[model samples]
Target: PSTSLLVDSMVKKGLFDRKENPRDRRSLCIRLSEEGESRFQLLYNGMKKRLDSLFGILSDQDQEDFCRIVDTLYTHVYTK
Candidate 1:
């Protein structure tokens, strides 16, 4: 699907606010609405809880190693 379609859908659902950018009237500034922020927090908390539960079984050193590996992968993927 096109990005415009996705943005339109979100706006229709009241999850996003789309407005003309102040600095560039030709462009738009899209941001999450209050409802979107609330939903995002709920989802983030749920995922964090699940991850914490799953990782709780790991030893401290194993957890550290996992974090290090994740950071390395994130850096490699994002820096490229």
Candidate 2:
């Protein structure tokens, strides 16, 4: 997989801005554009709202327990 190719495609799509690094001309600095940030926020909020609604169906205790279990699993999987 070519990461640079993917980045170039994203730049072409206007989702990312690529700038030359001041200290290293060979390196390019990439960041999400304003339009990309706006789109990402919209998608994040929509997913969060859907998850909140889905979790709303559970009781408070169940939700707490579910969160605890998820946290435990995350810790187990992510910790070195």
Candidate 3:
């Protein structure tokens, strides 16, 4: 129910749409709006470009090691 309220708020804020669920009349499907999609694309592209530039500064082997360390750190923290 709290998620539903959040979804409604997001829709009202123009980030997404609240559509009736086809299989369930009582349920609604939440989807990102066009503006939200554009915003997300911009964010994704910016992050990817930045990451690519950062990785480009490292040697291939260094990048591989960094990825492994990040993976381990993620697992260590998330598994806790």
Candidate 4:
């Protein structure tokens, strides 16, 4: 789905709040609502816990290699 559609859906669900952008009158500022913030924290904590558990099984060198591989992939995908 398009970004606009996703944002609209979130807004409709009261997960996001939009307000007039002071920097740009023509555009609006979009931010997570209180509910969104709470949900995000929960999701973040859960993911962090899972990741910590998974990483705990890896050696220090393995973790370093994994991070390097992830950085390379991110750069490749995000850069033109």
> How well is each residue in 38-69 modelled by candidate 2, as lDDT tens digits?
88999999999999999999999999999999
- What is the descending TM-score order? 2, 1, 3, 4
Q: How well is each residue in 19-60 modelled by candidate 1, as lDDT tens digits?
A: 999899899999999999999999999999999999999999
Tens digits of lDDT, candidate 3, 2-80: 9878877888889998788999998778889998898999999999999999899999999999999999999999998
Put down candidate 4 lDDT per residue, 1-80, tens digits, no spaces.
59889999999999999899999999889999999999999999999999999999999999999999999999999997
In model 2, which regions exceed 4 Å deviation? none
- Backbone clash pairs in model 1 (N, Cα, C under 3 Å; residues 3+ apart or in different chains), count: 0
lDDT of each: 0.97, 0.95, 0.91, 0.96
Using lDDT, rank the candidates from best to worst: 1, 4, 2, 3
Task: Give the 10-residue window scoring lowest on summed lDDT in candidate 2.
Answer: 1-10
Better of 2 and 4 by lDDT: 4
For each candidate in turn, the TM-score is 0.84, 0.87, 0.81, 0.78
lDDT minimum window of 10 residues, candidate 3: 4-13
